[model samples]
Structures are given as C-alpha cells and as structure tokens.
Target: MNKSELEKEINEASERIKTRQSEIETEIDRLGEQISKFTNWAWIFVWIGAFVSAFALIYFICTNTEKGFGLNLLGDFMAGTVASVWSLAGLFFIYVAFLGQKQQLLNQQLEIMYSQLEVKYTRLELSGQKAEMAEQNKTLRRQRFENTFFQLLSNHQEIVNGIDLKRVRDGSWTTSAEGRDCFSTFYERAFPKGFRLRKHPIEPTVEKYAEFYKVNQSDLGHYFRHMYHILKFIKKSKELTKEEKYNYSNLLRALLSSYELLFIFYNGLSEAGKPKLKQLLEEFSMLKNMDFELLINIEHKKEYKEIAFASSEERKKLLRTKK
Candidate 1:
C-alpha cells in the first residue's frame, strides 16, 4: 500500500479506540448511579425488618394467652381490632407519658414564677413597714445580728462548756470565737467551713422563750436529736459482721457515756428542763431494737450503770408534768 492509504487506515483505527473508551466511561458512570440508588433505598430494609419483628412479638403474646392458642377465624375482625387497639394503646401511652412530662415542666415553671412574685411582695411589705423606723436602722441591723447570735447559742447549748484548756493552749480545736465541742470538732472535720447544720428546731423564728425568761434549756433540743442519730447509727452498723459490730458498739457506748452529762442536765429540776428531758426519754424508749442494756453489758467494759440508770423518782417527776 502507498503512504497515504496507510495513514488513512491508522486514523480510522484511532477514532474507533476513542469511541470504545468513551463507552467504557459511560458504563462506569451508570454503575456508580445504580450504587447511589441502592444506598438511598437501604433504609427500606431496616423498616421491613422492624415491622416483621413487631408483628411476630404481637402475634406470640396474643397466641400465648393464659388459655392456650385459639383459632379457626382466630384473627377475625374483632381480633384485628384488638390487635390494632393494643398497638394504638402502646403508642398512646408513649405519647401520653411525654405530654404528662411536658405538663409537669409547665407546672414547675409556673411554681417558680409564683415563688418569685411572693418573695417580691414580701420584700416590698418589709420595706414599707421598716421605712418609718428607718431612724432605727442600726438597731434593726444589730437586732438581726443578735437574733443570729442567740439562735446559734440556743441550738448549741447542749455542748455545755467545750473548753479544753490544754487544746486551747495548743490551739488545735480552739477557734477565734467561743470554745468548741466534740460535735463541733467532728463537724469541722467532715465539712467545709460555713456549711449549715442539717437539722434545726421547729420554731426557727422564736429567738428565745418570751417575757423575761432566762435561757435555761439551751442545748435540750440538740442533745435529744443527737441521741436519736447515735442510736440509728448503731442499728445500721450492726448489719456488719458480729466481731466488727461489737468493736463499733464499744466505741458507740463510750460516745453515749460522754453524752450522759447532757441527759442528766435535762432530767434536772426546771419547768423547761423537765419537759425537754421527757421528750428525750420518750424518744430513747421508742428507739427500734436498741436494747441499751444489751449494748452496755457487751464483753464487760465495766458495765457503766449510769448510761441507762434512770431512777423511778425521775420517771415519776417526768410523768407528773403532763400536757
């Protein structure tokens, strides 16, 4: 063949190769499109599986009613209605629970708003009442301070004199203010400074017993409550092994002995003093499973008779002063 004829044949072959490459790229693009379509529809399989599961579960529960399986028009219109009702009820419950929660949140928000409004009104009333007595602002501030001081004093009166002269010289348990007690020492150890006591008397606002009354029974309430807690602690602690419990009980006995002074002071003769003592006695009597005698006589730590030793005269005196 001549040179021109050979060139013409090569050009035709190159054109055919280009056409085949374009066709192959188009086929790859078509396959990629098919993959994307399948990915989009993959969620259908999940729903289909979930629906089958739900159907099976409902069927099994219904079939296995206490009376064995029933059939031959078993899935009648009534049965379908029952199934639908069951499904709807389940969905309805979920919906209702969420709505109830939403309603509770709304109620809580409303309560907060009401509380703010009440506090605002109370402040306004106080401000109005005190404005005329503005001249005595210093006295009011001082009274507020005194009220806190006396209130604290009454609460802590059970502590008696907590002065350990040796510790005072050492400055270990000593503070800048009045002497501290064992309870106070424990309190500071357990918590950070300025944390308030968990419990308080019922009448927080009554600064003192009214009308020329001496603060005779300062620690009466504190001691009574302190006894109750110690008893409860003993009861809970007894759940440990017998040996551990016995050891712990010995420690508890010592603590109770330390607190006996408070009990005696309560039982002493005074109107306020007598009533408070009676309450503690009543509380002590009602303590569940706390056989004070059982605890005291354990392994003979010199059976300290004073812990439970209440005389008949003291009992009679407490009993005589009734409501």
Candidate 2:
C-alpha cells in the first residue's frame, strides 16, 4: 500500500463514521424539537386553565358574597398562585429540554472526532506498506545486479592489471539534475572515486568492491552514466558478437575478480593486507649476482616510468614486492 491509498481509506472510514454521527444528531434534534413543543403546549394549557378558573370563581363569588367579601378575594389570590406555579413548571421542563439538546450536541462532536482518528489509522497503515514496497524493490534490484555483475565476471577471468590505468573523480550526478536520494547516497559512498582505467577500464576498485559487499548503494549511476559501457554489453550479451562478449567478460573478470579476491585474502589474514615494503632489483627473472643488495636499499624515494607493452608473464615478473 502507498501513502495515498491509506489516506483514501481513512477518508472513507471517516465518511462512514460522520454519516452515523449525522443520524444520531438528527435523532437528538428530533427529540429536542418534540420536547420544546410539549413544553410550549403545557404553558399554554396552564394559562388557559387559569383564565377559565378566574372567570368561574368571580361569577360564584359575586353570586354568593353574602358570607364574606374578603374570603372570596383570598380564594381568587390562591387561583392566581396556582397558575403561576404551573407556568414555572413548564419553564423548568423547557430548561431540561435545553440540557438534553446540549448533551446531544456533545455526542455528535465526539463522533466526528472518532471518525477522524479512524482516518488517521488507515493513513498510517498505508504509509507502512509503501515503505515496505520501496524496500522490496531495492532488494530485488540489488539481487539482479549482483547476479549480472557476477555473470560477467565468470566469463572474463583475468587477474588484476598492475599496469592498468583508470581515472578517479567525484560521483557527480550532474546528468540527473532532477535530484539525488538514498540510492545516489549508496553509490557515492560505495564508489567514492570514479576510476576509469584502460587495462581495468571502468574499474570498480578493490576498496569499492569491499564496500559494496558490505552494503548496497542507493544508486548505480554516477555522473549520469554507468560504471562502464560493459554494463550495456552485459545487458545485451545474448545479441552481442563474440568479440563484444569477450571484451565485457574480460573486463568484468579482470577488475572485479581481482578486487573481490584481494579483499578475501585481506580478510583471511592481517599482515596479508599491509605487508612490509620490499623492492626487486629487476622485474624480470631474478638474477642471482646482479643486485641482491638493492632488495633492502630502503631508499623509497625513487621515480621511474616505462611506456611499453609487456606480456602477462613479463608483467608478473616485473611486480616488485612494493617496498
């Protein structure tokens, strides 16, 4: 579920609750109106009774006032008192009716509040679903990418290229001017540098590989491009020619395998990662009498550059144990 879905469900639930609340309000209103009508009629009847009694008592007093005029006047005063008391009773009933109406209004408001809470509950549920969906998509993509990356690795099985060169730069998402998110964060953190080497063309360095194994990146694209064009070739390997396939295969295996293997060896032992520096006098086959003393020269300040081609075996012999 997504945010909107939960919100909508909440809205629906609220509407239902509101509708019930409206019905309750209607019932309360009806009862209130009836109570008001009864109170009004009672007051009218009390006034009418007072009027009829006053007329009859006046007629009787006038016809038989030979006993005492003062007593007749007192009887008329008592009749007036009875009428006022009945009127006061009607007013009391009206007050009770107002109290009932107030209670009903309170109940209606409570119902509305309850409806809103239900809406909120639905919204929360939907938000959780959306989060779960996003996570699942990330997991699926990571699994797919891993399978594909490894598949390319298996086809091309070259060791690390010591002479290979690569460019390192920032993981600028300049192309994706839209914005960056967690995905971009992942990629940048994982591949902090962009190194595009020839022998290790579009390299994913040993350091970066180790990082990826530890956690998934937020995004795979940096500078709005892939790790290499090998990515495209990997995707279309089935349709690519043999040379294209081998190129991708070799690229992936040469860089990735060495990177992964290097980390594995590092994890297996502590000293394996950072060995004491050593130097070889000659990169080729070791000579016995040539310069054995140079091995421990301890002069690390030496600069040399060679621009030439060498076979795999020749390059291996050239790998002096870095001092």
Best-fitting candidate, scored by lDDT: 2
Worst 10 residues of 2 by lDDT: 276-285
Q: Which stretches of candidate 2 lie over 4 Å from their true place?
A: 1-12, 56-65, 69-92, 99-323
Residue 64, candidate 1: alpha-carbon lDDT:
61
| Model 1, runs deviating above 4 Å | 1-215, 241-246, 255-259, 262-323
Model 1 agreement with the true structure over 109-212: per-residue lDDT tens digits: 54454344334333433645445333333333343333333333433342534323234556455454333344334323322232223222322211222111
User: Which of the numbered candidates is closest to the native, going by highest TM-score?
Assistant: 2
lDDT of each: 0.39, 0.42
Q: Cα lDDT for residue 110, model 1? A: 40
Candidate 2 residue-wise lDDT, 1-323, digit = tens: 66676667656765776676567657756765676676777777677767766765786678665756575665766667766667676776777677676756766565456645544664574567656544543443443444446643432322121112223448532333212233233334444433322122112243444455444222222211222333453545444453444344444434432223222222222222223101111121112122212211212112111201223344444444322
The TM-score values for the models, in the order shown, are 0.19, 0.27
